[model samples]
Target: MSAPDARPVRGKRPKSGDPVVDRALALLAAFTEEHRALGLVELSRRAGIPRSTASRLAARLQAWGALERDEHGRYVIGLRLFEVASLAPRSHGLREAALPYLEDLHEITRQHVLLAVLDQGAALLVERLSTLGAVQVAYRVGGRLPLHDTGVGLVLLAFADAAVRAQALSELDSPAAATLRRRLADVRRTGVAVFARRRPAAVSSVAVAVRDGAGRVVAAVSVVVPVDAARPQAYEQVVRATALAVSRALGARPARAE
Candidate 1:
């Protein structure tokens, strides 16, 4: 599989001036979705590290199982990282509890189903299930998405703590912030959020929150469909029902019908 967010490593220079740490990170960041495997020269160029440094660090990373060379002597991300990432409580724990419902939803709709939660200031996708003919989306398990632009994100932002909301707003331009505020209000009022985008692909999404026993919104679940095939409104009730079932399984009380 391709690397996740394998963009050029960017930041102010590491304050500690630790060559080992800096070069190690640079090597890891060199892999992206489009450039999954690379030879020494390309890896060094992409990582902005000296060839010698990249070679040294790559050797260490390989020794540690963080990276492995392919048949052509190009490096690829190793399975060890995935093994470690599976221990993350926010994703793994919630995914374990929500998998049955997610499977049911996928079976019923044969579309993309996502489970996500707020991480830092973004929506962190914990799990996703997509069928062969499902609408294409630029999301994957363990990927981070913008808080205001995704269905799961809208639900998460709608129920996020004030501090997280504030942080997200502070980062947006005033116009965008205002639009997000309005959208969040709507999500809160309606108990669900629907989102769509046209640039990348014409797709629509419907999402709802999953609450814990204390009524705290712990996660969001969503479905994505091609715009031409979309019946977002029709999917709303099903998504909400699935979320409620998962929430109840996680110990949340059933809401009295209004």
Candidate 2:
């Protein structure tokens, strides 16, 4: 397959000035969704390191199986990195518990189903399932979505600790913060969030919170569908059911009947 175009990496390089570890991490961070592979010069430039330093670091990383060279001799993220990432309890454990229900939801909707967790004040997508004819959406697995703007995000933010919510609110403008406060209150009251976005193709997402055995909200499950295809509320019940199923799989207890 043809390599995607290269783009500037997003985050700042570490300022610790550690020769080996920090530079190595910078090299890895240089690779992104659009720039998955890079030649020596591009890698060095993107990592803000000298070519010679990048070559040495890349060689070490390649030896450690954290990076690998492709057929075209460009450096790409290695399978070993994924293997290591798969051990992360937050993402991997949730994925294992939620995959079955997520699959069922995907089969039923034949649209986009997403599982995400709150990380670093944003919704970090852990898994996404979509079909060929599904409506276009900008989200990708491992991407971060705004807590104030997305359905899954709203569910997560609403159930987050008050301190966490306050920290997130501090980042937004007054009007947006007020709007999000109102929306978060609604999510807590209704146990679901229906969010619509107009850009990147008009779509609506219905999301519900997933809880663990301890009754702490841990993740959010969502379904994204074309706005014109159906009303967002139509999917709320099903999505909530799916989230409940996944939560049970994760050892969450059923609520006592009133």
Candidate 3:
């Protein structure tokens, strides 16, 4: 018979020597956009570990500076985690190269400007800027959006390596999968993607791919505006220009005239 303290682990065991690593990670995952801080009991419940185990893991994390105590005495993700996360090449590197252009787009348009990259089969928002009256969007920094439903997603899909594209296609329902293939071809031909989003009520986005030194598409830049205010296509040139500028900053040279 199992002892009263035993609790089943939530995820796959880590191959590393520290068997508690996965549990520690699960504790970290317990905090999210909605639940930014938690008490020991709540953290344990959410992480699917015993309270005793949660306390021990939290102690270790707090000691290592991966977690911190809030003024309210709840546990929160720590500065040390941010220090580590800031080094992620896909987000930090691209954001460093894209911020000036993204800020410019926001200042010029006074709208929602975003930068995204393909990550784990989704469009991961790396940065976003919005003006006082800018249209609201569903995405936030660190959030993921569907590659099939967003303008940045289309750009990424159009240029994604065959394996990533194939994996995405295989995950969708047959009809939508077939439709995406057609859209990808159009995006490739035009070098831009424009799409209307129904959420936040009738917003449209225009986006273009940003390439790296080897001319490999590494990220996308986009702007969101009201559908009735202006056609999304109207922003295509500026978005393309911004994306191109960022690509150049990353050491990408323009393609030779055909």
Residues 110-177, model 3: lDDT tens digits: 88998999988999999999776766677899998889889999899889989989998999999989
RMSD list, candidates in order: 6.1, 6.2, 3.6
Give the per-residue lDDT of model 2 (tens digit) for 142-171. 999998889999999999999889998999
lDDT of 1 by residue, 51-156 (tens): 7667888999999888999999999998887788788767897898899999999999888999999988889999999987777788978678898889999999
1 or 2: which has the higher TM-score? 2
For model 3, state the Cα shift of residue 130 in Å. Answer: 0.6
lDDT of all predictions, in order shown?
Answer: 0.87, 0.90, 0.88
Q: How accurate is candidate 3 locally (lDDT)?
A: 0.88
| Candidate achieving the largest TM-score | 3
Least lDDT summed over 10 consecutive residues: which range in candidate 3? 1-10
Off by over 4 Å in 1: 1-19, 171-173, 254-258
Residue pairs with backbone overlap in model 2 = none
Candidate with top lDDT is 2
Query: Model 1 residue 82 lDDT?
Result: 74
Model 1: what TM-score? 0.82
Candidate 2: list runs displaced more than 4 Å: 1-19, 256-258
Indicate the residue-level lDDT of 248 in model 3. Answer: 90
